[model samples]
Target chain A: MNGNESVAYNLDTEEPGAEELRAGFTALRDRLRQPAGEFVRAKEFLIEKALLVCGMVSILAIALIFVFLFKEGLVALQNASVTDFIYNTSIQYEYDPVADETVAVGESTAYNWQPVGEEPKLSILPLLWGSLSIAFLAAVFSTLIGVAIGIYLSEIARPKIRETVKPALELLVGIPTVVVGFFMLAVIALPLKSFTNWLGLGTIYVDSYNAFIGALGVSLVIIPVIASLVDDALKAVPADLRAASLALGSTRWQMIRRVVLPAGVSGVFAAVVLGFGRALGETMIVLMCAGNAPQMEWNPFLSVRTMTSTIAAEMGAAQQDGIHVQALFLVGALLVTITFTLNVIVEVIVNHYRKKIRL
Target chain B: MSAASRKSLQAVREAVQKGDRAPLWAAIFENIVRGFTIAVVLMLVFILGTIVWEGVPQISWDFLTKAPTDGMREGGIFPAIFGTIFVVLFMILLALPLGIFGAVYMVEYVRNGPMARVIRAAVNNLAGVPSIVFGLFGLGFFILFIGRNLDYYAFGTPRDNAEAQLIEEQLEPLRAQYREEAIAQAKIDELKGKERGDFIRGYVAERMPAQNRKVFGQGAMFWAAATLAILVLPVIIVSTEEALRAVPASMREAAYGLGASKWQVISTVVLPQARSGIMTGAILAVARGAGELAPILFVGVTFFMPSLPLTEPVNFGPLVIQVVNPFQEFMHLNYHIYTMATQHPDPVGTRSIQFGTTLVLIVITFMMNIGAIVLRRRYARS
Candidate 1:
């Protein structure tokens, strides 16, 4: 710019603001500053770093949850042995007068979860049985209905019905579980029990708050979850695949069963797995209605206590640092671990399914 | 293709050629599935109708305005409503920044990489963690660890808040009568002595609590809201991530072309476009977190609290303001319903009131959820 200005001055001794023009151009370049100034760079760097940290909070939260649960749960270990924790209740011990020790032998197969009895039992098997049975039963019922609904939404529904029903189901899912728990406890349990009794099936069904009742309550909560998940999965199948199936002279059912369902099977697995995880960890409904007997029986007709219900029902009453609190925390730890692992599985399956299915 | 699929295809071909039974049978199957969907929808309607029908008549103006009496059977749920609002406000306040920033990082910065994959997996896991596990963490971490440390460091000892308040109240007259005048006179007299120092020292120590009371080390609304923030984080992140993803890449490039920095481009361009999405996610997360009882069950929520959770009204000379005190253990509508159904001495008698509270909670959550969904759909379309 100085050279050009000097040449212009040499050519015509006029317009002597060339030096000012050069300064202005230099100032403009400084203002543009393609490689921005240090403070701006520092601020950008700091914000980027902070955002990355915020984004990583989920992983940090999972770790923290695991740490805190185990830190509290391991308190029980300070009081009892691992064997005692795992094997509890219904052990018949014989005291030999000569031996002086109350030992001999007894089968430790029985699993009792009586955490507050004279001799507190901490076996998780009863709770496990309850959770699995309830989850499985709920899964079986909700899946059949939920999947059918999903298929209908994805394939057979008229546009208007689909539009209305999908949002309704979404709203249904958003209804709090506490409400469902209330409905089960106050509305469903006694009436259903009486109906079963009038039909002479109450004898088998045991009580008002049987496992069947609680499972049905949970099914109500998870049905919408599963339906929405399955609907999304089926909707994710490529449009051309459906069109091709129809073009091949296949019936609509044949198209769904053969083409769309096959394509979305992995997604279905992801949805079912997620649904099972949800049911397994469901707390309020089971806590309210499942009698909480802690019976080791697998019968759906009988009362049982699930791991989640055990935590929800007993955690508040448990002494802050007592063995019961530790045990409850351990149950929570176990529940989270299972659900966490289930999520990992679902993620892997969905990732693979997405990669395969996306055109 | 697999043999089963191949055979199914062949079966489809033969059925189509026959055309006699396939279409009719398919129609019946389709009808059955349609019936299933209708049944599910109808069942939802029936349950919602049951609650609204049973609950609406029970809800009067007094029901919304008054507090429960006669062991929670007689009056309204104003405290629960207030506490629920408090928790949700704090929940969204904490969650929105964490969630939006995190989503911004994913969408605007780490578009795709191993880092993105890990972040996605972490989010999915967090979202899938059981609400009850969140309760355990709220107790173990927030109350036991953070709140305990807060009390230990700030307050010196775990002491009763009422006693402390009582001491302050008692000392008020003493200060007005003696301490302030005495100190002022001492200073005026230019008496620099141990007497004044001891008197002043003694005056302040008198306000220190003498009785046992739990404070931050126990359940409080702040901790419960914090726990709920974590609970709803993934919901916000996932939706915001999608919303950010939807903003066209060309807009970002255009901002850059105009000599904007990355942050400037994002804030001025990307975020404005995604504002509705973020708002929708915020509402949805609040709706999701507020109705949850598990995280708040032991974290802060009380089964019976006679008063609302607001602080004493502050007078700014002419104007006065009162806000919720987040440190207090408060009542929540969901927990109220839980307690009413299960812990009431007379659950049968309290049934109507329980329905009333449940209806309020149901209405709030449903409105938020449906509103978010509607907004998202409308925004996506336009």
Candidate 2:
């Protein structure tokens, strides 16, 4: 036993006279009545109570958010049929003489929402297409640039350069998305439009310069995100693997390509997925640059809406029981589920890599 | 083609004496990519430069101080300046304590349990919800619930027509002549209600109708604050929790050994050490707050709330109001530039203005971010 334990043990083992034992027994009885363990246990219980309360408060906050959303969402869901809601391709019109009801006489499924009857053609397809197209484009761009930069920072760049660049990229995380959107819409989009016009590109002329502009903007915003994440993953590759590869006479680039990059592949994959989730859910940039079109189209040049843009644009006027309102909530739920799944998948992938590497 | 063959070939080449200079192709490729990275950085800088060049010339003391008038086609954003400040300050007040308290509870009190984990996960997800969703909730709950009472229920609607204006202009002198009579009528009404105080008696005669105009629109400042608070709460809570978690377990144990209570340990040992972290989170939250625009739309966020004396009825029909009013007019430096570039009535003014605003916004965001990072880094080291 350690020194302190031995002393305590020796003290316990010693015997004494009956009078001494009686006094010692009385002292022991008093000590047992007010055990140190009881104090520690009580403290632990209070801490547990505090933790429970903290957990409950957060739960309460989220519950309130869900309650508010579902209460309104259920009302909207009531009148909507499964087919009419997602597939009917148009709002229906009805008139009932018995009840003297004249329903909204919408025709040809003008998939537009001009609540004040200002813009008659309100289609969500275009906006959704735009959001997805831009987000996908941004993901592609960020992944390419980020992976390359991450590799450069982790393996290629000198220590000084990496030191400067790493913090610079991480700083991008703190920038507000709105500022990025504003920069793209005002500075980049206009110039690109002018340049494309000057180049006499009919596609650029016909399609959305704004959508492409927004994609580029969002890519810049998240480049740091992807780069930092990928860098972390790249760094996680064991140094011994690099040393062994070098001893085998492989060049730096060759060792990185064959050993380090391959070893860190899961992390890189996880980073891309994480970045994609972020890109999909970004609201402000798409809202500003998507031109708020809601029709479905495959063309990248056309102005389109995303689910997020639809929520931002329409949530203000959507009546609690209206189809438009329910659709927005549904879109939100869909997005949450998508991102949540992505996050879980990423966590599993990262954990698997960590276990495999054991570092 | 094969790796073995390639290695043998490399050895043979090295034995033959390779050139000192790197290959031309590799050099060229390196230069090209390096150039590309520089270009990206330059693009951001260029955007910021343009915004400053355009907007700085327009910014002046007079522009900052004078109230907006003449359909906000003229000078100043005094009301907007104050409104933005008040809204941001109020939001900080609301979010700071709650987020810190919640973080403390999570880190200090709770053990690793299933329920705690669930709550933590839920909070993380809630952080991802769009700010506009918060705006929608604010509109339904805050504006309709609270604003309705303050603006519509308590205050009478002011007359809007030219006829009413004519009547007011003509009746003013006559009302002055009949002041005693008006006072007597007010006193009688007050006594009928058995009012005990002079303030209540005077309130009936002096109560003005709600202004038809507002500083921004209707409920802009309050809703803007609420939306911002919601936007920053997650960031604050996450950062603060991380900070609190960083406190050593031994510190708590030591405090307990000294016979300190659980609350006493947290209040004395845990919180003081986490102060820098909490401050850093607060700064970052403010940085986030300044960049938000989506929720500003639903709240009566005008570019400028007209400068009215605080004692006067709040009216939003000023140039400051138009700045944030997306539906009607645009006025904040950002919105103004957006409109100038995209929806401007005139094209010549659009390009310059857009560039200027973009530059200013970039600079502001960059500075704020840098400040936050510095704070975060300092705390991290500690």
- The candidate that wins on lDDT is 1
User: B73-160 in candidate 2: lDDT tens per residue?
Assistant: 4556555445545566767887787678777776766546665577677676667555555665565455554554454334432222
What TM value does chain B of candidate 2 have? 0.65
| Residue A164 lDDT (model 2) | 67
User: What C-alpha lDDT, on a 0 to 100 scale, does residue A19 get in candidate 2?
Assistant: 55
- Which CAPRI level is candidate 1? medium
Where does model 2 exceed 4 Å of error? A1-57, A87-123, A203-205, A317-323, B1-37, B69-73, B140-220, B308-364
TM-score, candidate 1, is 0.85
| Tens digits of lDDT, candidate 1, B173-212 | 8566555655665353554577667766676556544434
Ten contiguous residues with the weakest lDDT in model 2 chain B: B321-330
Summarize candidate 1's per-residue lDDT along A1-359 as a digit string, tens digits.
33335434333344688667766765665565466789889989998999999898887887899999987768777778777667764657888889898974775566678788678888987888899999999999888888888898888888888889988888878889999888888878888888878888856557778789888888887888888888899999999999999999998999999999999999888888888999998988898898888876756879989999888888888866668888888888888888988988988898898889764
Interface RMSD of 1: 1.9
| Runs off by more than 4 Å, candidate 1 | A1-35, A89-109, B1-19, B158-213, B318-320
